[model samples]
Structure formats: structure tokens, C-alpha cells
Target: MALNLTLKPFERIVVNGCMMRNGGRKTTLTIENRADIIRETDLLKPEAAATPVRAAYFLIQSALIYPDRRDALTKSAQQQLAKLATVFTPQLARHVFEAANNVSMGEYFTALRELRPLMKRELEVLGPAGLDPTSPDELPRIPT
Candidate 1:
């Protein structure tokens, strides 16, 4: 099976750990093999993984993109998922579990897709950290 992706001008994408930027025009990509691909706009940065679910997904992404730290990343991801598994809603829990399972089974991209639901909404799954992932910014800051 082949997947067709159309990228707009200046669009950036990451495929199997390679970051590719389209030229100054619309371009289409045909992926014929099982590969990981994410648009630049959809790329979750580590700092931007402010929510627990986002953090969990970031861990999986890091592991997949940076093989040098796979073990450490996987361990952290597993721990976070384990903590979340016991406290989240059944639906969210299922996604977390499935994502974790996918990560463990070396299906990193699928794992990220599985976590989409949890990352989209404001949630209240608290663990030892007791951080509020849903709280809005108390004060806006000007980035340096």
C-alpha cells in the first residue's frame, strides 16, 4: 500500500528521522513502505510537551528519532504511562495503554497516533507529580 502526502510551499516534514523541507511550491510525496512521517507543524517539541499526555508522546517520539537514547527514553515513557494508566478515564486509559503497547512493540508512529485523543482535551489525570496539565497560563511571558 502507498500513502500520498501533499505538502504546501515551505512545508516541512520528517520521514523516518529525516527532516525534509519542500521547495517554494506545492509538492506531493508518495510513501510506498511502512515509514514514520510527521509534518513540521505537527512536530511536538520537548519543551512544548507541557501536558502529561504530550510528555508521554514526546518520549515515544524521542525514542524513535534518537536511537542513541532509546533505552532511557523508553524507560521514562513506560513509567509515565504506568502512572497514567491507573488514574485516567477508561477511554483515555485505553489510548495510553495502546500507545504504550505500541511503543513496546516498536510501533512508534502508531503509538503517537494513539495518543491524539488524550492530547486534544483538557484532562485531570494526576499522579505523584500532582501537576495540573489543564491549567491555563497564569501570566503571559514574552519569550527572549
Candidate 2:
């Protein structure tokens, strides 16, 4: 039995990451096409993964809009970064700054890098709450 599939515009179907621009048309996937997509996607994955800091930075870009909450998130992200700082090199620092800068969280990034060792040493004395990291979902909510 043969099956027919329809895709809408802006719809993305990634068989191997060769992103078929579904301009409201049906495109057949061949072995070569699938392989090309996969190879390209694989090559792009690392660059994609590197953008999280940029994302975080953008998320925190409106820091002035939510000073207290931004401050809290900054503090938490910094703490996490600090804990991992000893293992993080200057290259990692650059990446973090790049990401932070993308979201205007440069100050937070700087603070985290500076306080990494202190935060790590104080981890033992800190409570579980202090050790717990805040996720975006845990951010302060605004009433509708």
C-alpha cells in the first residue's frame, strides 16, 4: 500500500535535518536526501547547542523590567556557573559571556565568574535551598 502525506507552509519535517521547505508541496525523500540532511544537521548540532547562553541572555535581557526576579535568576545561574567554574576554562568564560551578553546579563556573568570559587567552598555550609537551582519555570509569576 502507498501512503500520501501533505505538509503545510512553514512546516518542518526533519528526516536527517536536511529541512525540506514545505511550500505547501509534497517532496519525496530519497536515500541521498536523507543522508544529506542527517550530515548537515549533525554538523550544525554543536553550533545549535552553543546558543543556550544566548537564549538565556535574551530571556534575561529585560532585566530592568523585572529587577528582583532577574536578580534572583542571575544569582542562581551564577551559583551554578561558579560550582562548575574550576572545571571551566577561559574559553568557557568567553562562551558564558557571549551568551550573557546576548541577553544583557553580562553583569551576572561577571559576578558568577568572580564568585565561583567562593560559592563552591561555601556549598557545604549552605542549605539544600541554597544548593537548589532555580529553573525558568520557577521564575516569579505575574498576575494576568
| Model 2: residue 122 alpha-carbon error in angstroms | 25
lDDT of 2 by residue, 16-112 (tens): 2234456666555334321212111212221221222322332333232334465665554444344444544675565554434433434432433
Of candidate 1, the 10-residue stretch with the lowest lDDT total is: 135-144
Q: How many pairs of residues collide in each model?
A: 0, 5
Q: Pick the candidate with the highest TM-score.
A: 1
lDDT of 1 at 113: 89
TM-score for all models, in order of appearance: 0.77, 0.25
- What would you estimate as the lDDT of candidate 2? 0.38
Query: Poorest 10 consecutive residues of model 2 by lDDT?
Result: 34-43
Per-residue lDDT over 1-144 for candidate 1, one digit per residue giving the tens place of the 0 to 100 score = 999999999999877778889999999888999877778877676556666677787788877766667778888888878877876679768998999899898788888888887776534344424433333462111121
